[model samples]
Target: MNNSVWNVTSNSNLDTLALSHSTVDFASHGSTAGTFATLNVENLSGNSTFIMRADVVGEGNGV
Candidate 1:
């Protein structure tokens, strides 16, 4: 398999970011286990916080 990891970039007026109301868990099937995440940001706007580029954003929040 090829190694190709990436993150989403955003253009925002806000200079900071904060994760709120997020939950994470893991599921196991036989000998393997996978991770999951769930995130909720009721309000997304500028003059507030930025969309953070994280490896884990709770059930996998990605672009």
Candidate 2:
């Protein structure tokens, strides 16, 4: 059986709510055969009073 894999290509945007449509950018890369990555809301933006969340999904397969 093949293992499930997930990775973060980039955050690239942390859509802010209080700043009238602002965003922050982040980036990461990794490898996995049966693992996943997660970026916390706190890591989204350096600015206080800003919030971010993600339900993103990624996949990988063997050749």
Candidate 3:
């Protein structure tokens, strides 16, 4: 996923979000209602951009 954008509007939740690529973009949706409990990222290479809010992480499985 290179230069990808995920728009989380409202009432959105994710159990496990796994992404393997050079670049991934959440469109800075860490502040909105969209959230994820677990994030699995693979292929840690060069020039990778993962924009996810801290509060949006680990917010799954009734956390």
Candidate 4:
């Protein structure tokens, strides 16, 4: 499986509540046998909050 990932960060500290959103899309070449996907977050510190909402909309054998 091929992996394509990205990361985003803020230069300065956030004093107020910050709203952020991210979207990741994965595609399996021509052959669509069995595929696995995952998402991970690392190094969370200070008075920070992390909320992840995933909305998967697709049409295929396994979506």
Residue ranges of candidate 1 with Cα displaced over 4 Å: 1-33, 47-63
Off by over 4 Å in 4: 1-22, 28-31, 42-63
The Cα local distance difference test for each model comes to 0.30, 0.33, 0.47, 0.33
Q: By TM-score, highest first, what's the ranking?
A: 3, 4, 1, 2
The per-prediction tally of clashing pairs is: 4, 0, 1, 0
lDDT of 3 by residue, 1-63 (tens): 344554443343444454444444454445445454334434334344566555636778775
Please provide TM-scores, in order, for all candidate models, with all chains considered together.
0.20, 0.18, 0.31, 0.22
* lDDT of candidate 1 at residue 33, scale 0 to 100: 30
Report the CA-based lDDT of candidate 4 relative to the real structure: 0.33
Off by over 4 Å in 2: 1-30, 46-63
Q: Put down candidate 2 lDDT per residue, 10-31, tens digits, no spaces.
A: 4333343232233322222433
Top TM-score: which candidate number?
Answer: 3
Question: What TM-score quantifies how close candidate 4 is to the native fold?
Answer: 0.22
Residues 1-63 of candidate 1 have per-residue lDDT tens digits of 012221222222433333343321122112223322333445543332223323444665563
TM-score of 3: 0.31
Q: How many backbone clashes does candidate 1 have?
A: 4
